[model samples]
Target: MKKVFTIIVLWVAVVGSMTAAEPVKLLTYNIKGHGMTDSRLDDIAAVINAQTPDIVALQEVDNRTFIGIKHDYLSELAQATGMHSSFFALVGSYYGVGLLSKTEPLSVQTQSFDPSDTSKDKEARGFLIAEFEDFYFISTHYSLNADDRDTATAWAINFARKSDKTVFIAGDFNAQPTYRAMVTFKNNGFSILNNTSAYTFPADGPTSCIDMIISYCSELGQEYDVAETGVVTSVNGLTLSDVSDHLPVYVVIDPIEESGVNNATETREMRLVRTSGGFSLSSLQAESMVNLYAMDGTLVDSHWVDNGEEVCFPASCRNGLYLVQVKNGYQNSTFKYILNH
Candidate 1:
């Protein structure tokens, strides 16, 4: 029994000239249980205030634990930075992950991940979601176990799929970019927004990249552009290693405006149909330029297509996932496709 499958994704579309909105700055950090003294807390707040992020995801936070001297670390940070905060306990009311934002969230929700096994040694991990007017921000701490990390990734993806607004997730994933969990995120439509080459762990002399910020926009017609991204190793004149064990990572995003001169009042449409040879594109705009790229970003083929014309895949193209970018006048759109031969 031979089977063949061709999967096409028509969800992502960009049709208009993009206008820059007020960029949203997001930060993620693991503060090593917020240190042990008030001075340490002040140092952490200094780093955060210097960055001036709109939203912050904090991991390894302590809340009135025996070691924390009954102090709420997240509350202290929120007060110090003049931002709203929410905490989701992962190990009773003692340890957890938290979120701090400049504006109050519209709503907040939390969920605990399922343990990998029935072992008391396994640490509990959870995620918190805060809904804003235009997007949803998530803060989470994934378990060290691979199975548990996969579970957490699946949970986040399911949650994002059900949301109507754009989704941004940040946390100490405890997995590298090449890890299975990270690959799963990309397969589900999320894109890692931070630089993977930079390390974030062991703030003193980082060598591992375990903390990350990723985003997914479920809306087919909406798009966001990354304006800036960085791994914060120092704040002002102070080195961040003195305050936390992991460096903070931040990303600035600008929403792309959907209205532009080209096809502003018309609906632009394109279709990819599987053929006996490979595949063909139909219904493209007049003088549309098409580019085929492998998942690894290698250009496979390109062509200038016209309305009612057919553009077939190159014979040298392999069986795998690819990106098809079509440009017509001022309009541009990207589509994901999978070919199994």
Candidate 2:
């Protein structure tokens, strides 16, 4: 009887271990030219570091060459946070979008709407699409032109519908929810965050709610939960500041798992260290499988590293932290490490 009871307990443990809850956290911000002189970058970094989000989407990222400071805003943040990042210039010197993730991306692509027509300024602006393990995410800044805005909206929907994976779309869309473009996108499967009327732009007045985030399922049968959503609000009674005439939006999502409850365990004492090739697995045990994923939550690689095994990452590995998942039988663990140049 004791042996049978032990067997039952072990079975339950295995089932629990196999059930892993990996929540993907996302943030969208329009950091005004990296907040050049206001010292807002420090505040922005503080907020991001505190959230420790898995992915971040940024708009108005500077790419101008003449800027004496770091011209690549996203790259600088990626370096500061040890996360992999990508950027797309929507308007060259004026508007751009960026994606930063702690996980390595499978592929990065950019698309610029029709630039031939000068009337379509926003359409001339481009968007960046990032592919992670089982999901695809995009960021953009829409054109202020109404026709271009509508066209851009349609273009985004068309792309989302054709994607083979789950999608997360975020950026400064420049259109209210009441706008036809916003409505049409919602009619499809996109669920927007902050529907409760959030004030996002101009920083001071009451005109918020344009900067937005929305998500859609990839396949016909899969399910998703909005989980949690909100504005970054203010830290120490100070708002996102006048950095870009916009505020930051954030959302956390839980993708449905097939078997048991999906919950994450608290990761304590987690630290990322630079490594040649890649990183080493220290204090990890044998008989455990490890999965390396990009910030968009895409699995880049998986294997079994022997207990206390140290393996060098591939040279082509980009600079960023890789989400490391360690699983033994039914129980699981997660950690992150950074790669630097």
Candidate 3:
């Protein structure tokens, strides 16, 4: 009896240590290309900071050549949010996939899945993997076509299977949860984070679900709890002001260590994504009203502006949410963004 008790105690100690050492707070965001008209890097940072995710996977990043400023988009994001950054160029020119982390990742890897030899655009797809002590995170974007998405999903699952480690995958899949590709992810041990199937594409006019965050665990016993998962509705009351066509998906995982954790609310920086449409007056005003009554009365965002500084034009006012409010009897504005995955 004494020996059996000692063995049980030892096993409990080992289990406790493993659970406590696991990384917490992982996230994925598709920051639309960092470019001139859509310079919402600060806004993206704000959203990221608000979530306080330890690991982040990003898609549609600009290398600075074709996009806005001639600065590395991932680097700018890391600096702004005080996080580490890594990238894998898929198109060669500017567009690519990237990873960002507040907690330093142990092992980072980037792989290109482009099979077409036609050109950069035809071949612009890849994955970014970053590992924490016991968790591995992957971020990627899939082709709009069903066939192409299948190939991407296969590659993603194979990579995750290569290790028995706990894994998380996030990005703009461009495929719905009911799609066969998503089913494959589940069969391979990855489960979708969001319980309800919510639309993520076309941030303003989301019609169907696309973006996602998937996780892999042994079973329900060793499984990580999804604290919260849904479309990120607003930033500091700005409401996602058409930052992109796709609404951002936010997912939080509970670490084995803590329970009943509350999400932290913080003022976010700004990010602008360049798009076809020009800026909106709403993007330049403070304390403006933002409404997204698209089939759901629950989706709402509004805010009052405390600062009244013009966010500048042909530079700062890219694809994102701008604050408009009365300041010194003049209208001032700040900016944020939603990257369409």
Candidate 4:
């Protein structure tokens, strides 16, 4: 009896160490070209910082198109949010989909899928997968056609199967939960997070739940347990208020240390993504002063501005990283951001 009790205690200790309770946060957002102007990257970062997600999937990204003012929104995002960014160019066009991770991903991979059909106007659809410590994360925006979605679904499942690790996918499917594409995911062991009937598009008035977070863990050497999942609504009274056409979705996964990948690659930074109407800072009081400083503690710019105003950084500002300090009386807040040109 004494030997049996010792063995049971040993087993319990092993399992307890294998599965830590700290959950990993995940978020998905379709930022509508990540906002219209170059300066808006900071605003988009603000939206992401507010969520404090460990990983994020984004769709409808503009790399460097005719109308896109920024040369590489991905790098700017990396600067703005200080997250490792990856992009998958769809149809060889400037527009595409991609992902960002709080931790430097172990690996990044991308593949184009048959969208059933493609025309000059319709860009090809694709998926980007990032390898983290224990699980694999994939991001893809599905085609508008039923046949295309079916094709993408099969490809995604095969791709996930390539790795024995648990896999989670998040993006805008452009289809309802009852669609055949979703059914295929279900049949292949993928389950949608937050199956509640909450809509995600048409930011002013959402009517359908097109955005989804799907996960698959099974007998093929996969293991994961979800802590919680839900839709991310707007940040009240901030620059990101009503920022995009669709609302973001998020999830928290338990035992994040299972695979021995520590996501603490860097310190968390705050970014302010712009709203459709433009940036708005409701937290600052009237007569607040703003100062921009380099990481080396060199004062670069200083100015006095009113609250709820959009302060666009001049193009002449040297590129790299900067510390943005907002001061009102004795209260002050500082933020770090990358400024890759």
Error of 4 at 227 (Å): 1.8
TM-score of predicted model 3? Answer: 0.64
- Tens-digit lDDT string for candidate 3 (222-334): 33555445567677844565454556676666555323433222122221223223222211112333222212233333332111111222333234443322222233333
Candidate 1: deviation at residue 117, Å?
Answer: 1.3
Put down candidate 4 lDDT per residue, 132-212, tens digits, no spaces. 877888888988877888878888888776766778888999888779998788667676654335567777777888888
**Ten-residue segment with the worst summed lDDT in candidate 2?**
265-274
Candidate 1, residue 163: how far the Cα is off, in Å: 1.3
lDDT scores for all predictions? 0.78, 0.66, 0.61, 0.70
Candidate 1 pairs with clashing backbones: none
Instruction: Estimate the Cα RMSD of every predicted model relative to the unseen true structure.
Output: 15.4, 19.4, 16.3, 18.5
**Model 2: CA > 4 A from native:** 1-19, 64-70, 92-95, 115-123, 220-222, 237-239, 259-341
| TM-scores vs. true structure, each candidate | 0.70, 0.65, 0.64, 0.65
- Candidate 4 lDDT: 0.70
Ranking by TM-score: 1, 4, 2, 3
Better of 1 and 2 by lDDT: 1
Cα lDDT, model 3, residue 315: 36
Estimate, for each residue in 214-268, the C-alpha lDDT of model 2 and write its tens digit.
7666454234445555666666635656445677787666666544433233121
Best by TM-score: 1
Backbone collision count in every prediction? 0, 14, 41, 11
